[model samples]
Target chain A: MIAAMTNANPNIRLDKRDLILTKGSEVMLRRGYHGTGVQEIVQAAGIPKGSFYHYFASKEDFAVHALEFLYAPRLQRYAQALGDRSLSPCQRILTFYGELLNHFRRQERPQYHCFIGSLSFEMAEPSQPIGLQVESILQRSVDILAQCLTEAREAGELNAATDCVELAEFIANAWEGTLMRMKAGANAAPLSVFLHQLERLLTPSP
Target chain B: MIAAMTNANPNIRLDKRDLILTKGSEVMLRRGYHGTGVQEIVQAAGIPKGSFYHYFASKEDFAVHALEFLYAPRLQRYAQALGDRSLSPCQRILTFYGELLNHFRRQERPQYHCFIGSLSFEMAEPSQPIGLQVESILQRSVDILAQCLTEAREAGELNAATDCVELAEFIANAWEGTLMRMKAGANAAPLSVFLHQLERLLTPSP
Candidate 1:
């Protein structure tokens, strides 16, 4: 949707829009939504303040787009992992989380599952629009995982009695909680706990 | 420590300090840390800006005290629940969460598990002092639960093979994740799943 808008305005350079969003999200991720300012983000991106307004209607609008901007490729990767045929359904889920853990482990500090977790936490109350966007994004992720879990159950890898959507919601919520802890402690031990428990959580029922 | 300071300085009124913290935390919870200002907090507190400074050295300092202030009574209640003699150890753990869920359910809004959860989400990266305080609070909670699980094991209610501390951390992290979801969706369904999964997660291993 935003891409259409960018293309419609021939004056708006894709690179510049991307630059503002990239820098804006980085600052927002580091300092949080309320912690960041439009001028600061424009400065970080080496763009004029006017250019930010040219591309975005308001700080809130920028955030809504920033969220979609940050999520697009990552969601693609997530969707791909969920549907990967090379691995069994259960294997796909575990391996996906394992790779994510390794990514966070390399940082040696709390990462926000790429900042969406924090934005959602920060936005949910203050800005209804962004909160709605964040919730929708979360639901998208949950839907992806639920689809994978559904396959797992059908393939006899998950418990036949399992409700895939509910389980997916639990795993996603649990992972979000683990990220909150990781941020507070600046440690990844909770990530380890998340992964360990993820295995137990996915085991088939008797 | 703060109580001692209050007693030593007859100039400072306990009720005034409490007012600032109570109002400050409420604003901070509704607005992200960076979203709020000392002026706004003081105005809401119905106190002079000087009063806020007298009790708290800085915004960071105020947040640290606020974190401590918000946590004190809740921690006391948590310790009580963990050590509650009427219920079995596992029952104590589950009942504690059940009661908390009911509290959030009554509000019809996503709550912070009493604001500490959101503060931890917001404070960790931007402010070191507050982050450390939040981590310590989380550690305290995890410790209480771990102690309860230890008793549960001793009473033969838990799987003997269970690593009580690790499991406690997982449960704590998972509950935090659950709360994050609750805040995002403004729904209590996640809480039900947390309770359901808590039972399964706590079940003795084969």
Candidate 2:
């Protein structure tokens, strides 16, 4: 599907920018940053090769923006989910997993979760700059969740002894690893089982 | 540093088969399955495209072998680590993480944790056959660890009430996620800290 390009920088004439990023995101999410070709992006976006160069200085430039474009809203949803007043901290965290499981089951059939993570791993081998951008994007989300855990602890909603930073990192990684296992597993039980065990971990024993 | 390729199969010609798989392993590890080009693999292997096709019917065939090539040793080491009779089951598990942490620190400079979980994420989208191969590799490792955990429980090495399957899954994921965060953080402490916490979880509290 060709999404119409929206210009974020009018002075820069980024008319084809959004189209490139959208198409590129699809390809990269399916493939990966190190594995994708600008030619493929141009072909997928239905833009000329020359037009791709005109819109972005290089493939790396487009990928950095694409990572943000692909991940920003997902991170926002994460923040919102963590802040949900109607749910307990533990419930909200599990709800985030539920939402992700729903995404995995979608007809579009995304094979993985966390593009920032995928790119971080693929790019870590070669490109320092790209790896940093992806890591910062992930860390930002981790920081937000850590803050939520802090708030939950203060509200007497979590065990006071729980280390919020470690817990946040744990939840982030559990989700990340769960997605990988889910895609790799022939069955879906791994995802739900991980979540159930996580709930058991977070819930205080009476 | 280029390593000489050794053929594991006697029926296959050693030089040609090793050339394709060794180079293919590097490309897939560095770029991922879909992101890598057949041309790139052939060039790196210094084999003609025809020679490449002579050994493997398709990229999928090459990828299946590459996935196996990448993970087979790691799996062997994991089994050895679990089967070491000198160490208690809990200590064996801790030693496994310790050994993995050393590998992470050593290769953290050059993006060392190559295949296993990394490629699993990248190929999750396009390479179903390769994905299955990787999944089976992971599942087999998890099964081995689960068995160790079961032994630990039966031998009274852990709390009799400890859920072996869940704990094994958690330990496996902690390593996967910790590698990513440590890579992102550019520090090894997170990996060690996770191992420490895991040991605490595994120990029998009086």
Best by TM-score: 1
Q: TM-scores for all candidates?
A: 0.91, 0.85
* TM-score of the second chain of model 1 compared to its true counterpart: 0.91
Per-residue accuracy of model 2 over B1-206 as CA lDDT, tens digit each: 12334444544576678778887778777766666778989988987899888778888788888778767887898898998989989889988888767876786463555576666776654667877897788778888899999999988988888888877776676667767776665667667667766776787756
On DockQ, the candidate that comes out on top is 1
**Docking quality (DockQ) for each candidate:** 0.60, 0.46
Strongest candidate by lDDT: 1
TM-score of chain A of each: 0.90, 0.83
Clashing residue pairs, backbone N/CA/C < 3 A, model 1: A177-B177
Quality of candidate 1's docking, in CAPRI categories?
medium
Clashes of each: 1, 1
- Encode model 1's per-residue lDDT on B1-206: one tens digit a residue: 55756586644577788889988888887777877899989999988888888888998899999988988888899999899999999999999999988887888675553466666766687778988999999999999999999999998889788889988998888888787777777888889989988887767766
Quantify all predictions' global Cα lDDT against the true fold.
0.84, 0.75
